[model samples]
Target: MNRRSLIKAAGKAGAGALAVTALGGAMARAASTEPRAASAKPRIHVGSDPGIGRWSHAKSTSHEAGWTDQFQGMCTDGTYWYAVSNEGDNQRLHKLTLDFSSTVASLSAPRGSDHIGAPTFDPQRRQIYVPIEGPEPELIWKVSTGLSTVGIVPLAGRTPGSPAPQRWKCPWIALNPSDGLVYSSVFGDPERNDLDKYVDRVWAYDRDTGLLKKEIRLPSKVYAVQGGTFGNGGRNLYLASDYEEAGNERKHVYAYDFSAARDGSAVRSWGKVAIPDADDEVECVVFAHLTWRNARDTHITVGILDDGVFSGSTDNVYFRHLAVPSPGLI
Candidate 1:
C-alpha cells in the first residue's frame, strides 16, 4: 500500500493515541477470548521487584555515546549481551557482559546503515542480522561476530525492485535455534505515528537463502510488535508490543506455539502477559537464563527506548524476574 493508502487505512480503523484510550475495555474483552492453559495464572506481577541481574547505560547526551537507546535491539549468548542502537550520526553495537556490569566492546555500524532496528544473533553462524529501516527499509545487514559487514539480505516481501506500496518496516528479528530460521515482525502506518492503523504480520524466512516461507497475519488488537524471540528451544514464540495505554503504560506480551506457526497455521494466542512499568514506549524483550545454572530458571530482560521526552531517566534496559512465566506453563 502507498503512504497515502496507509494513512487512510489508519483513519478508517480509528487508530490513534486517543483511540487507544477506549481500548481498555476492548482489550480486556479481547484477553478474555484468548485460550489459556487450564492451570495458567497471571505470570507477571507488579508489586514485586524485578530480577536480580541489572544494567544501566547511565543517561548520556555526549555525541560520542552514539545514543542511549533509540528503538534498540538485543540478544545474548549466555555470557554476553549484544545491543544495537540507531544513532542518527553514529549507529553502534555495544557488547556487554551478561550481568550488565561491564562493557566488553563497542563497534560502529558501517556507513549508510541508518536506522538499524532490533537484531537477532545466530550463534551457529556467528552472525548478527540487523534490520535497516528508512524511507525504503527492506535490507537486513549481516554482521559477523567480529563486527564486520558480510552482506545484506533483502526482505522477501519488499525486494529491491518491487513496488514500494507493499513495503514494510522490520521492527524486530528473532532466530529460532531449533530450526535455524529467522523470524521478524513487519508493519507500518506510513506517515502517521498511530500504530493501531498499521497492518501487522509476522514473517519467517530462511537465514541461508533469505527466502520467504510464511507470513502470519496478527490480530488487530496487536497494533505493533516491537520485539520477538523463541523460547523453550523454539516450541513457543514471544512478542512484545510497542505502544501502551497512556495512564497505565502496561504493554501486553503475546505467546504463540512456534511449531504451529512454522507449519503455516494461524498463530494461536497461547497466553498473554502484561508488563506494568513507568515506560510508556516498551520496545523489545529477550528471555535468558543468565543467573541460574538450571536452564529452567529463565528470566526476561526488557528494553525501553528512553527518549527522555517521557520519563526523565534515560536508563533504557531493565530486568524483570517476576514477569517470567512458569516453565511448566510455557
Candidate 2:
C-alpha cells in the first residue's frame, strides 16, 4: 500500500514512444512487491505513468499509437474523445477529437452482444450512454451522443431494442457530474473460462430518471468501476478486482461514498484499494478506466491500457506513456 507511482512494461511496447521508465528508492520498493515474495523484492523498473504527481511516463515516449487498441468503453466530451472498440471481431463504435480525429459517429455492432461497455456522455442530457452486451437480458443503448437538445430530453425507456442472453461482464462506467448518476458494475467473465458463473451486480441509474438508482448485491465479482471528484465534497465510487482464476482475475480496488446511498442500494465504504501486482500478479488484472484529467475541479486519473499482450508482450498496444514501477497500485 505504499505507492506514489507504478506503471511497468517488461519490454517491446509497440515501438512508438511512451517508453516510460523510473524506479526510486529500494527500486521503487521492489517494483511493488508481490511475486509471492518468500523473500527478495527490490528491482524496481515498472513502466509508463510518471506525471500525475510522481510517475508520469518513463522512456516509452508515449507512442504505441498513443495507446489505442480494441479498447472498449471510454467517454469524454469536454471537447472530444470517446471509445468502444475492443476491436475483437472488428466491433466498432467511435468518436475522437483530442487530435485523434475520426468522428461522425462510428457504431458498428449488429450481433455478438455488440460488446461496448459502460460509456457515458450527457452534457445537459444531450445523451450518449452506450451499454451493450447481449447474450441474455442485459442491454443498454441510449443514443443521440450529440444533436438533441430541447427543453432537455433524450434516451427514454429502452426501445433501441436488442435484448436476450447478455451476461454483462467487465462493464464499467460511472458519471455523477453533478446529477448524472450512472454508476455501473454488473460484471462477470473476467477474461473468460466461465467458472459456472458467479458475479454479484452493482448499478445506479438516473441519466434523467430512467431511474434505477444503485442496486448493489455483492459477495464478489466486480472488476472495474470508477468515479470521484471534489475530494470529499460529492462523489467517489471505485471498486475493482472481484476474484477469478485461470480465466484471469484479482486486482482489488474499492472506495465508495456516493452520498452513502440512502436508497440507491446501500454502498458505504471508505477503504480497501489495491492494484499492486509487483510480480506474477497478472491475471485478468483490471484497471483501465479512471480518466478525469487536466484541472477540472481537481485531479483523478487512473487508466491502464497495456495491450502489450504479455507472456512475452509484443503484439503492440503499449504507449500510454511508459515507466510505471512502484508498489504495484495499478
**By lDDT, who's the top model here?**
1
| Winning candidate number (TM-score) | 1
RMSD values for the candidates in order, in angstroms, are 11.7, 20.1
For residues 182-214, write the lDDT of model 1, one tens digit per residue. 777554433456543454566777765566666
Show where candidate 1 strays beyond 4 Å: 1-67, 135-137, 158-168, 188-196, 245-249, 262-264, 292-298, 309-316, 323-325
**Model 1 TM:** 0.68
lDDT of 2 by residue, 9-90 (tens): 2110010000001111111011221112112222322221212223333211111332145443345544444555544466
* Runs off by more than 4 Å, candidate 2: 1-64, 67-72, 75-81, 84-94, 97-118, 122-124, 127-171, 174-181, 185-213, 224-304, 307-330
lDDT score at residue 47, model 1, on the 0-100 scale: 22
Clashing pairs in 1: 1-165
User: Whole-model Cα lDDT per candidate?
Assistant: 0.51, 0.35
Question: What is the total number of backbone clashes in candidate 2?
Answer: 53
